[model samples]
Target: MTAMHRMTLAELVGGLSAGDFSSSELTRHFLDRIAAHDAQLNSFITVTEEAAMAAARKADEARAAGNAGPLAGIPLAQKDIFNTKGVRTSCGSRMLDNYIAPYDARVIEGFNDAGAVMLGKTNMDEFAMGSSNETSWYGAVKNPWDTERVPGGSSGGSAAAVAARLAPAATGTDTGGSIRQPAALCGITGLKPTYGRVSRWGMIAFASSLDQAGPMAPSAEDCALLLQAMAGFDERDSTCMNEPVDDYSAGLTQPIDGLKIGLPKEYFTEGLDSAVEARVREALKHYESLGAELVEITLPNSHLSAPAYYVVAPAECSSNLSRFDGVRFGHRCDNPKDLEDMYCRSRGEGFGDEVKRRILVGAYALSAGYYDAYYLKAQQIRRLISNDFAEAFKQVDVIMGPTTPTPAFRLGEKADDPISMYLSDIYTIAVNLAGLPGMSVPVGTVDDLPVGLHIVGNYWSEARLLNIAHRLQMDTDWHKQIPEAFA
Candidate 1:
């Protein structure tokens, strides 16, 4: 109990079961930590003290009745993009400053039914648009490891909150690298499940086809427990897959021997930081020692990922974000010349710069004459990117690489250069483009910044990915490598 801050989800559940601590006590500890550190971290946009306490009380009642589940009473933070009933779900944008969802997201309902306590909503890039969380309307989230550096975005706040242990685990959406890159920078474990694996009905859309929600927790095993509660097909979401929920935790003991993991030559090429490559290679070496085999694979069109992603993601975003034109909820302008002025001034003042840039880019991509040259071409390339993953999967059980090209950079490092910021997600964007599952786990640290080892799995391969990560975690101390201050 003395090391409660570092305890994993399994450990916490077991401790709670044995009467070592009450759910309320555990929740208080996290809440206290948030209050103490969140000012500097800026991880949460809102903290639901009343709801969390009510849920904790109910969880204690369930435990007294001997009907508590493993996930019962666990306090979880959610990315602000998720619409939590009565909570301000801003998606880190000012446009939705007044928007209060009347209903919970499908994932939120799942967690609620499972008896998980809602801690609050974490910050993210505005509408999940930026790679570096600098685009958030609230403000940038600082990396827990290095306060001067960023926590990675659009899911930066989720990762930072988990890394700082403000909450045990949280939910995050990945459009490109939001979850994985932030998890990489924050030194926690994050997973973007296969597209359609989770319902997206109430999540604020970034890029409809590419955005997928997943878990960000202390480790992959925790992700399994969370995903167990947070995942399932929902009739409300057309894209949600109508499939049986697999026993993800049951596969934690599966053997990873003879697993063929592809290491894309493109990922290790120039522009990848030497320190990150070193640590990833070392992790891959450990995998090799476990009897897993590695092969150099070629994804010839990997370089086109950013351009293709920008084009396709923006086109989807422009259409999705049009709902925030001051009439339907959200923020309104102070004065309006007319209907057109109301829309223009509202959007012009409410949305941040990066958001406007994306809207313009996306609108142009989908515009009349240029649609064929940009949006259509991007869609075609997206198919090819997905095809690349499918082809690689035929010969490999999974793919491996560095989550981010480098550890979290200084907060303002890429703030001025959008292209450079986009490049930060180079390693992670393909998974979204291909609609494949991907994860980021801390494998090592470089210059005090934690290095994330990226794991890519084929369709519906989440359990397998977790198993591989668990084995590696058993043999390595990477997960134990917390930032010096937090430790």
Candidate 2:
């Protein structure tokens, strides 16, 4: 039998359901791996051993009672941004280091209701701000595929952990390209649910309008499994839609032959690395070989996404982060002249430099003098960006592109330039602006680092996207291949 640490989340769940393994046995296997390798990967910020074991025991009991679900005994990691009951939810910021949540985020509650075991919290960018995990207060999360490079962020730890087999399928939140970019760099499958599809009640706010949670795993089928449990509505999040959540896994077995796939004309343009473009183009041919039709589509306003998103996201963030003024919770200043001084000093000390920069940018953009020039203009651009998608979808079932411009670059390659790091999200950001669903599936690799094939669908096209991704996986060895370092 293969070692537990090398198996996919789907394989583990199947084994448990068939009585091939016990939850305790699987739980211990992951705990042992975490103890052994997490020191280098920094994939986890917290490991919930007691809670995991108790949940595993409960799963065993449920199986005894014939109450097993697809993920009954599966142990998975959570991004620290999620508020887990009695568990620390740091959002990778020092400000809330000691703050434990009194309640689980709606996504966490949904997963618990579905019988999945909680592995622990994974590290991420401070307030989900940076494209690389180096922005984390804890430390950078190393790519399991190439330790010398980054895993990608702000969902960096979630992707790295899944790639490293630290957990089966972990939860991640994307505001901009966090989930998709990390999944690409880490060589896994990750889906960003359509905005408002998943309740964000307990997720620590990054950019309230853009932040969305989803699943990351080794394969698209596995992403479907986890997404099934994490999505839905909560009255607490007014932005959460009351619409019905469909079974995301239903399309995993369906062939995508005859489906219309549009390739954005701009996605393959300048700034794209040759190797990455070649790999993604080949993946498209593979889909064509499977009978899917491909056509060229234009998103004329595509270049406007980074500029527009930078404005809108920071504006929302400035308002959301206003709560961290030292009086309520999180880090507090030592001795202060007055309450106002304490509030100012604590936030200055707790937030990272990048976060502060965004706050300042956001504050300025929303200020009366600059409102019409920046914030208002960005909102108009956002609508135009979304309109581009609406036009493209009218002619195709989905859109496909390279999840990123290149494979994971060496650590510090783009660390000094914030604009460079933001550009890494080019392929994934427009989907967020449109509030549509997007996914990243392992396609092939360049050199040793992983590359991802990006797939975007109209709102509620998750099932179709997963099905196409799974069928593509069936035809190739990409998803099955693990990093040589681990082997």
On the 0 to 100 scale, the lDDT of residue 316 in model 1 is 93
lDDT of each: 0.90, 0.90
Model 1 C-alpha lDDT per residue in residues 145-190, reported as the tens digit of each score:
9889999989999999999888989999999989999999988999
**After superposing candidate 2, which stretches have Cα over 4 Å from the reference?**
none
| TM-scores for all predictions | 0.98, 0.98
Clashes of 1: 0
Candidate 2 TM-score versus the reference: 0.98
Model 1 misplaced stretches (Cα beyond 4 Å): none
Q: How far off is residue 377 in model 2, in Å?
A: 0.4
